[model samples]
Target: MDGTIINSIASAERIWGDWARRQGLDVEKFMPTMHGARGIDTIRNLNLPGVDPAAESALIEKAEIADVDGVVPISGAIDFLASLPPERWAIVTSSPIALAKARLAAAGIPFPRFIVTAEDVKVGKPNPQCYILGAERLGVSPSECLVFEDVPAGIKAGEAAGADIMVITATHGHPVETPHSTISNYDGLHAHISDDGKLSVVRG
Candidate 1:
């Protein structure tokens, strides 16, 4: 729900950039690769020679907490979510539980009834574990769930899980490729959720 439901990418980038700079690392090269990765996995993939793992963990933790206050809900997200039947939706995120909760609470977003966090999944986005788990937790088959994602990795995960995915260009700054459909904003998302529980973009 982070980048899609709440516009937290700028805040996330700023926090990671500051942390990377303090560690004498190249934020530009590192931040992009870390975008949709699990928190600890992002640090591990950095493979910074001579860097202390414990210190990196501490830095990431602090930065994520500090950035929470800067998160804002995407325009129309609240109304779109409100219009849906909660039982049919869920949040599958790469964020660890603590950081996810912080960002959601900061953005004043209601906690999703079914949530699958990075901590709960063995594999992260681009692997589909989170999305699959979310579908399971919601008592729905993957094919019946409609995933809303802002990044290619998240979109890939949803697709891999057999769900029809919808792309929201929030964090990626470009369109994500998804087989089902895409929307620039959540303004028409409610209409897209049909009576049969399938989602489709409303044509003009």
Candidate 2:
């Protein structure tokens, strides 16, 4: 999801930025840190004085679901995803279920049949738990899966889970640290599945 299948940056920044201002934190310093993290975890990490992490996290979830304006699919994401077999793919996102579905719907991306959201696992990204669970739910080994991620935490999770990783540069459009591959977006890439069930990616 987010920055991969859907471009929810506008809404995400708006909501999180507002939260930061309300909490008297530096929005510039705080914004990037929030990506690829669960809301609850993010709040706890902030460690703001006089704030309840759990309550704030719940509020953020509500805000994210309600602020779906400007959410849209990343370029070529819809077509590229449609070309793949559903059973071979799953979205392992740090977003909660409601926000994930709302973003997908707003972006016109079909909600994935196999999705692991923040609520689905005890620990979030960079822990490998969610990604591992995703592979398990997809009925595949970790080595058999390819994860597309935008942020460092998600990339680390995919790596820790023993899956190949493709870092999407849509968020910052900069080189990442040691990803298996990097793509600007889903544009100009082709996915092919052999009769023997081998998947191949070709750059067009």
Candidate 3:
């Protein structure tokens, strides 16, 4: 739901920056690593000195909730999603249910019938579990699905699940060295997902 469905990175950075300031850490140093990661996972992976676990968890939750303010739809995301038949697509995000719903609603995007959130998976992105589960819930084989992702970890997950993955460069700066195809936005993604489930990109 983050950089893909909604561009919440700026809000996330601001919230995390405030948390880092209160903890006497350099916000700039930590924010990069925090991007595209689950809130709790970001805290655990920090490996920072003198960081309190409970306080960190509370702060992260607060930041996540605070970020609800500036959520905006990514360019062409809504149109792309709406153009597809509901049965052919699903959302596999690292966000929990409430946040996902809030962001989607705020962006005025139609919620997918099948969604696999961070809370629903044993492992998050780069693990393939969430994408795999989303395909299962949608009753579609992984090979028949096309995934739109904005981060390397999510790209890895979808590709590992045998889906045709398309990386959006809005998040994570530029595309990483993943094998999946990359696009600047979702503008022409609909034509790419054809009737037989074969994927193609028509560049203009």
Candidate 4:
């Protein structure tokens, strides 16, 4: 939800950049793979010896919760989300629940009734567990879900879950790796539901 619904790019960069520096890693390589990755998963993937993923993740989450200074809703995100039927959508984020809730509150966005966070699943993005759980919680088949994502990992997870994926391009100057339609933000978009239980989004 960082770049998709919430404008927390700067805050995230600050926090994660510090983490990278502390790990003696190059921020250049660190950031390119930052989006849609859980902190613990990322730490483990970095293959840093002697680093405890869970411990580091807790520390990172603490920093994130305290670093909500610039967090705010993405343009049009509020209206777009408010327009959706509550049961039709849910947040599937790579952040822990505490960090997710903190970011949502900082952005003035209400917490989604159904949320799947990093802590909710054993595996993180690119594995589809989060998206699968999200669809299940929303009482819908994965094929019936349309995922709005900002990172390659999220796109991959959505695809693996059998959902159509759309990339949000606010953080990146161009689209990342999602092989799907991309939008800069929620602008000019509207969602509709048909009598036959089909959901469609139109660009206005």
lDDT of 1 by residue, 98-147 (tens): 88898989988899888888779876778988887888998879998778
Give a tens-digit lDDT track for model 4, residues 57-168.
8998999999998998888898888778888889999999999999999999998889999889998999998998999999988988889988878888999999988888
Question: Which is the better candidate, 1 or 2, if ranked by lDDT?
Answer: 2
lDDT of 3 by residue, 1-204 (tens): 687767888677778888778877777787776666566666766676877654676666655765677778887888777766677678888776776787778778878888888689776778898888998998878987878787767777888999887777766664367666777767655546668775454544
lDDT of each: 0.77, 0.87, 0.74, 0.88
Q: Candidates' TM-scores?
A: 0.86, 0.95, 0.83, 0.95
Sorting all predicted structures by TM-score, with the top scorer first, yields 2, 4, 1, 3
Model 3 clashes, total count: 0
- Candidate 3 wrongly placed segments (more than 4 Å): 48-55, 172-178, 191-204
Global fold similarity of model 3 (TM-score)? 0.83
Pairs that clash in candidate 3: none
Identify the superior model by TM-score, candidate 1 or candidate 3: 1
> Residue by residue across 1-204, what tens digits does model 2's lDDT show?
888778889999999999999888989999989988898888988777889988998999999999999999888898898888888889988898888888899999988889999889988888999999999999989989888988888888988999998888877745666636788888877689889989877767
Error of 2 at 110 (Å): 0.8
Clashing residue pairs for model 2: none
